[model samples]
Target chain A: MQWSHNMRFFQSYAMKKQLWIIVVIIIAAILPTIIGAFWINVAVEILIMGLFAVSFNMIFGYMGQLSFGHAAFYGVGAYTVGLLMAKLSIPFSLSLIAAMLSAGAFALIIGYFCIRLTGIYFAILTLSFGQLIYYIVFEWYSFTGGDNGLQGIAAPHLLSSVTAYYYFTLVIVIAALIVMWYISRSPFGYTMRAIRDNANRTRFLGINVKRYMLINFVIAGAFAGLAGGLWGPFNQSISPDLLNWTESGIPVFMTVIGGSASFLGPMVGSIIYTFLNAFVTGFTQYWPLIIGIVIMLIILFSPGGIQGLIDKWYKHSDSSDENIEL
Target chain B: METGGRNSGSKSEREEITGESMDFSLIFSQFLSGLSRGAMLFLIASGLSLIFGVMNILNFAHAALWLVGAYLAYTFWNLLQPYGFSLWVSIPLAAVALSAIGWAIERVLIRRIYNRTLSEQLVFTFAMILVIDNLIKIIWGVQDKAIVRPSIVASPVFIFGAPLDSYFIFVIFTGAVVAIGLWWFLSKTKYGHIIKAAVFSREMVSALGIPVPKIYTWVFVLGIFLAGLAGGVQAPIGSITLGMDNAVIIQAFIVVVIGGFGSLLGTLVGSIIVGEIYAFSILFWPDGAMILIFVVAAIMLIIRPWGLFGTPMRT
Candidate 1:
């Protein structure tokens, strides 16, 4: 009787959580109708960049490796769609898959070299690879449009409206986020955290650390590419600047600001950063300076970020209550 | 970025004018150019190598200091334009200013995060880049600036039957002098030995009553000084633009990686290798030269994971 009661309570709790998630999704779906075009566009950007940040956190937060070349995969995904739609006149849905594939393939190659080292060396190598991609995109004028960038990219007529595109982006981004959430809870995620904590001990256990990391790298790239695929159509263009290390730095900054300790930390960070960027850039051109100061403060004062602060408060309250009870 | 094209265009035009005799001169001149390029890289990477050896932190914004130096040099040069020794007077001034800035950054920002993770250090410096870059833009505006080479070094001089720019030769000389001076300082001076000792075992050095943090500040300042010197010198040879921070820093990283992060001697050799590769690539494959650096670095990394001159790290 006691076991059955506990099971009923757990089932109800799970249902409530699912219901909340559904309600959130419904709100997100209707957001375009409620908001203006500018805000809806901002919303689309937030979702895409949010996915990018989450994918980046997989390597940084979960795998304990900060891969700085993330934007390279993101750019590759964007360019794949941009090129396919603009040059080959392919369907938008097919272009998205191709974007994921191309980005994943690129990640596999770069990750092979990058995974050989750890810590700062890995960061440098990934950054170098990213810059190489940017250089290619900038110099290869015939294919990439060089400095001018590729433009006029869009989805099919049915999804041509801004409202329709927002919904499309929302659905794809949510699906990707769900898959990422699943991966984080899976045994592979446990092994990742183990490797992060102690690679040698994990190696002693007969796990191929590098191979697992490479797999993680490839999956992260595929998801970043998905974000990029959405980005190309939404922005209606793609540029070499998308592959620049500055762009790569965005995810890093977001992850740190959002708190890398929790699974949803990067997603929360993405929302904050996107909104901050949208709002801040309107006030001053020295946004980078402001951003730098913000990041430095976060690193110094709240290394785990806003989510970390909340957790600390919750824990402190919980412990204090127990002490009072005692 | 147009710096690449302008430099290449002038080289090709000079080749067209020289015509048949261009081959021998081209090889010799390219070699000279390569050496000068390597020397500049050495100037930048030597400081980076020192900081990494002693602090074990790679300051990604080290390149931003170089940009700052270039801009300061531009300012000083313009202010002292009436003076006959404008370039001579301005370069050292820029280097000094940069050292002060570096000192503050090390004390105020870097000191706060000494106990944090490597990723935090990287993010800190990366943020520093954004801050510095914007500060530069705010002060200097978005336009690219260039200094006129001092009249003494502006003209080309005939050396080995090839006309080489005096400024280029001077850069090579400056690089060699700095390298030798650094070696002497490390090997001969008491403080230099302390710095080296600090790199080996900071806790032990600190336990022995040496102020380790002070040494770190001095080492960081010296690194920034070298970066400033490289930038000030290059201001005349190349355009000092808003994005030069990003452009040169990656090359500096390639130099450090090839030289082994903490090894000065390795930095010198790596700089030469990269410089020569860049020079030859300009002659043969201009469009792909930048990509080639990453490719070579990747290959070197895979073959010798610690780098050519780097010792294996335990982590």
Candidate 2:
């Protein structure tokens, strides 16, 4: 059996090209279960953060906003779920739903105020909102456990099996990614790209630019929150550190490292970053310094990022296009 | 963001009625404490503003210069401590040493990134912050170190019927001197005029044969040196620690935001406002103070996105 370049390449034996990507996703989902537990867990982190970074790209790459405070939504998701399960006796699945909605709601409010600003002002406003959330979480000691963080957050018993959890996460990731992919290709995405490419031109076209910005911003926040929901149960806890500006930068860095413009670029970057982080921490205490240096070098020299490098190499070697979907 | 909701809680009123202890003379000392911190903030912030305004480079690693100053001050103080050299002497020497370090950073790392966007500049500077902070940790260890207070500053001075530490007076003096010197440099000198012109239009200035890149290098070096000087002056009052860089940078950032990004007078007014707020808030509401200042900033941003004194950018 041979793989077809296009599902619609043959008129009678046709489907959509996106289905090929879905098939690849299905293979990725199953391959992890057969892998070792540690690798599976690491794959889960990559998937989650990959999702997180891509969500960030919606605002940063597509909308031309530079947010230094996205961890606000991520942390809200974590803490919302953590507090709900701990205090309100909410079911885990419902808690995740509630967490995502509330996070989206918060993003909507923050995005409403923030959409009015542009460039660095938008960055600062988002940051201030993030800091405000950090303050509340840090100070509300009795409820959020303050700096110590809420601990011992157990998932449903079915997810106690690492492989089971892997499959479960794989399914959710596929769903989430599809939703995000759909969002990016939708009319909304086109308008966002227009706004990013030329705000003045888009405004002159009679589009409700700020309204479109808020919609995408809230959607991105929702996906980020969903990613955070995965994180809390996987890690068994959430801390204020998860919500800080530094944590926010991880997604930004990974997105940049992976190639923010590509759909699957963040996934690739997260895998490399996570693996490198684990390995480097084992070898030396100064991991952040090394990582920081690498990030700087990459940004300065390789503006197109890892995916960009691969694309350049491919183009250089062959006149015919042989490119990865991402 | 909690929006300063008008339905005031009891906690809000409780914030309005706090009193100072009879050991209240310590209050004046603490007021000085805030002033010195304010001065340090001004030093770092003014440099950051200049780098932002003149170079159009939001170089986050500029914070590292403060750490460099503090570290150099620590080393100098240790060497001179055995010889009985006061912090006064060590600080100036350390400031000079850090100026050289600033020159090196400009020549090596910063000069290369002048053509980059603000986001790219931010990434470069962020990495530098991490690398420099950790290099200091590796060399100095994670432990904190302090410069000895000069004997003159150890003595108390009478002010407004309150006793103040002489070191506080010294801090105020250094801040005043630096502020005046910076004013003279910016407002009363030909170089200042060139830098201002460069700030507004790099291409036009370079077209006129002003050596714009050289000016950029000088501006960055001078900015970092001023930050280092601030750090050096702060060494006697505080410990030099790796994490010290973070808080100082944030405080500097707030000052920059409050001061109008590129204005020196704005930095001064902003620092004083923030300093006084922090000082009074400690007495009133311990937890709410920092958040309140940010709240003030958020409001300012909404009302005048350019800041109190900053000119609005052309979109």
What is chain B's TM-score across the candidates, in the order shown?
Answer: 0.91, 0.87
**Residues forming the 10-long window of minimal summed lDDT in candidate 2 chain B:** B1-10
Q: What are the per-residue Cα lDDT tens digits for candidate 2 across A35-138?
A: 78777887878888888898888898778788888999999988888888878878888988887898899999989988899887787778777877887788
- State TM-scores per candidate: 0.92, 0.89
DockQ metric, candidate 1: 0.62
Q: After superposing candidate 2, which stretches have Cα over 4 Å from the reference? A: A1-27, A30-35, A316-325, B1-31, B155-165
- Clashing pairs in model 1? none
Q: Best by TM-score, which number? A: 1
lDDT of 1 by residue, A239-292 (tens): 899999989999999889888877767877888888888889988988899989
Model 1, position A254: C-alpha lDDT score: 88
Q: Give candidate 1 misplaced runs (Cα > 4 Å).
A: A1-26, A317-326, B1-21, B158-163
lDDT of 1 by residue, B1-315 (tens): 332243445565645545756677678888988999999999998999899889988889999999899999999999999998999888889999899999998989988988899999999989999999999999999999988876788777644335778799889998999999999999899999998888777889999999888898999999999988987887888788897878778888888888787888889999999998888899899898888887888777667756787787623
